[model samples]
Target chain A: MTFTETLQTKKFIVTAELFPPKGTNLKPLLEKAELLRGRIDGFNVTDNQRAVMRLGSLAICSILQKQGLEPIMQMTCRDRNRIALESDLLSAAALGIENILILSGDHPSQGDHKEAKVVYDLDPVQLLKTARTLETGVDLAGKKLDGSPKFCLGAVVNPMAEQLDLQLAMVEKKIEAGAQFFQTQPVFEKKLLELFLCKTKDLPVKFLIGVFLLKNSQIAMFMKEKLGINIPDEYIKRLATAASPLDEGIKIAAELISAMKPQVQGVHIMALGLEEHIPEILNKVK
Target chain B: MIITKQKELDKILEKLKNRKNIFIVGCAACATKCATGGEDQVQALSVEMSKHGLAILGSMVLDTPCDIRVVKKDLARDDKAQKAESLVLLTCGAGVQAISSVLEDKELVPALDTMFLGTIERLGNFHQFCSLCGDCIIDETGGICPVTRCAKSLVNGPCGGALKGKCEVNSENDCAWITIYDKLKKNKTGIKKYHNIKNNAAVNKPQKVKTR
Candidate 1:
């Protein structure tokens, strides 16, 4: 089934993020996707994740679709103007890439290309609305398209954000803008997920809470300090003291997913270059 | 006011490689307040140029060099200014262009890079408050322009990266959306409307207007 069909039928949907290779070599990327071919509901192709230059997500998503894999193309507003964004959307449609996850990407300064110019011509909310508009057989300029694309649109949220009201407001805006599902930033503590679900329980949308695999205490610290994720010290301590940190990280992710399974509709796992261990983490989820 | 930063002396010298005699121009308004193009700065630049073996013909600090009338009235007819092979302008781009328009024959070189339209926080510190996108939407954002202040220029709301009221891209800057949310909450204003895509036609570059 397609990702949208899976979202509709599957009780506990699972999706994993895939970062396109920095170079033209797609062997490693395809190998990783092959590893989790049927394990998850969908493969979300990241668009230059963290603003690091990489092969474009559109090409990778198309390749995945050719290989009979459901690819959710992640689009960011950071690198393209309105014209390019709309054109890419139409191109994605023509390529038969259905699902789209729109994001207001990280500023270029945060990426490896610190000197790159940021083009956030369309805000994330506006991008989401634009996708919906294209689905209705019309472009943003009100011109009719020969063929429109249908998509299972998704957006992002930060459940542990201190600015809860603004986040919720944007959540509402995203839903209004045609976001059917939301994949959130990683929330380490179960209470944070519960708090977010409690606030968004009434909203008619699916929540795929972000579950990042913390490989070690240093990685956890980086997420806290650099990424600003709210990872509790308990998990970091567990990883720091454990003899096998990778095993411990897998255990922590599984434990969190098990705990979150009852509340959220799904889990979006971000293994971060350690995709080989995803099945090991999933094996321990029950 | 427009903010500016002085270019390195070496860069100016490189631009003035062939010219032996040079004249300096300064502005008394924004550039003067910014200390990039003031009377003191012009004198300092004159001395600096002289140390490089180039002769300084003359210098002038105009009231506002961005004004073509001021450029024509204060600098157009001066014998020393007219005699210089190159005119080094320690002013904003507008000021440099104004002088260029009036003194059409002179080879003009800008000694300062015009940074942005900003507000003066102190004598030396300046912060950009407007991007001059032409289409303004701060009315819905409680007067805090997310377009100008947000790192990603997200008009709808803050991106997920903001933490503890600080922007994820730069911790030194407060998250513009959070500040706007606070101000709106204080004023009991409702941010129910979602801002659509900004029209770029109004801000099409090399913008000009004819006021009636």
Candidate 2:
């Protein structure tokens, strides 16, 4: 079945993110894929996650699909211009990897070697629009592809931004660009999530709220202060007061999943070193 | 042009664990011009590995390894998977990973360290200019790199180590502060204007943060 069909069938679809290893060792990554197989609706393999070099996402996704797991290939515009990007899209379709998460990646400077040049030929919005164009057998510049790609296009959102209106505006723009689903950054506050959803009610896109497992209070604080994430102070205090910080963090995460269950279509558990805890989160939600 | 160095080559060989049957892979992409792990680099690696008594099974260089179609066709037609015990990649980390994505069983190794996205300084020299701090400071420095220029990455004037015309560390290269000073003066701009440029303290270093 197609990735979208699978997502629609699962009531509260669960997906996990896996990054290809930095070095040539694939045993660990393959082992991770085997562990996650059949447990989640689909797994996401990031494209050059954080702009640092690693294995390509399309190749990794292909490996996952070979293992009987559905793979969602994340495509970024940081490295490729329109020509290269569209070609890769067509290739993705040819390989039967249907789900795509379009993103205007972080600059090369944000990667391991600061000297990389960036090719921001098309931003995420433009890329989504280009994908639609490619579906019709045309390129971004209106040229024809030998054969077009059939893609289930997805985009990203940061709902925890300080400016709710601006974030909502971006959502609308993504929808206009033909994004069918959106996976947001980690959601720590239910109220803010509600506010974002309410504003985007008119958008015809499925929203997947990002639920990251907090390892400790330091990580929670890092999310808030450094990443501009909005976790309520009261929640932080509650986690701090708990007897076991790890257990408290899981409790808080479960509470978030419960709160957001009725609001969005699904929750994308970020696992983030707590892949084992996903079973716990899923068990609680079930 | 594909760019590579001996250090990167050493790392890839190290990953091979000194295996004998090796298939050296190259790319027709960015590395082709920099000449590090492109077609020539792969041939060079084959010979060098053979000198170390390693069996050079064969070599192939795709137009672009990241282009899935090219890689898929090449792998299918060549059937290097059957012949070579291990594959050594000379392209960027993306290219190496792309090849790995398709060939599930074969062992893949990276021959070059995928460093920063940089531009060629002259014909052969390449230098990094921006850090992509999510904030740009090019307007203040007159388009010359302060991030890579100043030894300390100082955004302001040259440090005490700046000499008459060259940097303190390397006399061969012009001092970054001197370049900035000359550029601003030539543009009839005040040096004070450049000092007020704020560094993006919040911008995290562009290293890979594995979010698995």
Candidate 3:
């Protein structure tokens, strides 16, 4: 079944965001995919996550689809212009890959290639519209395409944005841009998620709360400080003082997933190279 | 107006290091206001060139070097200009380009680097005001430009990296979005951000203007 059908089926969907390896040694990713094949409803493959060059998401998603898995191509506008992006979209559609998650990726300065030129030819909104436009058999330049991709379009949200009103505007804009669903920035605080969900309850889009397996307080702080993702003091306190950070982190993450199960359509687990921990955390969701 | 800075004397001398007869051109409008290609600046450069042991073929501070007609007509009358082997411009990039396009045979070297369309903040300080982006959204963005000001040029809103109302890229500068929000709040216009900027064909390059 298409990912759109899965979301509309009223069943709790489980998705995982995975990064492509930097090199051709796909054994690690293949093994992770093998482990995660049936476990996840869909796999969200990253395109050069953190702007560090990797195997292209198009290639990786194709690999996953061949393995009998539904891969959501997470495309960023940082690297490609409209022509290249449209070309890739048509090719991806031709390859039988269906789902796409669009994002305005992080700046290149934050990555290893500080000198690399960042091409934000079209921002996230434009990309979302382009995805929708292609489905209508028309490209960005208004030219009719021979064939178009039927994309199950998705976008991202930052639930903890300081200017919640502006952040809501982003969500509203994405919805207007033809995003069918949204996966959000990592949510560790249950209260914050509850508040955000309350504000956005009337919106038509289905939301998947972003939850990751936090290994330690140091990792939590790193995400908070370096990544600009907010981690509330309460959760940080628990991880900081716990004797076994991994256990505490897993427990907290599992607890968050359980708390949000009723509040959200699903949860997207960013396993952080600890794919095994995701299954373990799922076991604690009850 | 376009802002410019004079190129180093040694560099200008190095280009003239090979040529003997050199003519100088300066702009009276933008370059003069910025003290880059003004008459005084051009005269100062001429004195500096003579000190370097090269023939000063005379200089003319054009009313506007970017005006091709003025550039062609003014250079046409100067006796020393007709004899000069090469021309140096203390004007902005547009001026250098205009002269280059006009002077078919003579060598062209720029004596100033055009910076940006600047607003004079004060007597000696100039700040880049506009990015020359064709689609002017300052009307919607509370007269503050995220396209030019925001380090990421995000059209939607500030990036997650912004901290304490300051930009994530340069902490010293106030976040452009924050500044806009403050302006909108102060003016009671309501804080606004454009989720979808229309296709920017106007800003697409090789843009030309012909106002009748």
Q: Which candidate comes out best when scored by TM-score?
A: 1
Q: Name the best candidate (by DockQ).
A: 1
What candidate 2 gets wrong by more than 4 Å, as runs, is A238-244, B1-212
Docking class of 3: acceptable
TM of each candidate vs. truth:
0.98, 0.57, 0.83
Q: Cα deviation of B49 in candidate 3 (Å)?
A: 6.8
Better of 2 and 3 by lDDT: 3
Q: What is the C-alpha local distance difference test score of candidate 2? A: 0.73
Better of 2 and 3 by DockQ: 3
Clashing residue pairs in candidate 3, if any? none
lDDT tens digits by residue: candidate 2, B109-162: 777777766678775578766655555676777788766665445454443233
Pairs of colliding residues, candidate 1 = none
Candidate 2 or 3, higher TM-score?
Answer: 3
Tens-place lDDT digits, model 3, residues A229-278: 77887878899999989888889888988888887889899878887677
Compare the candidates by lDDT and give the number of the best one: 1
Error of model 3, residue B191, in angstroms = 7.7
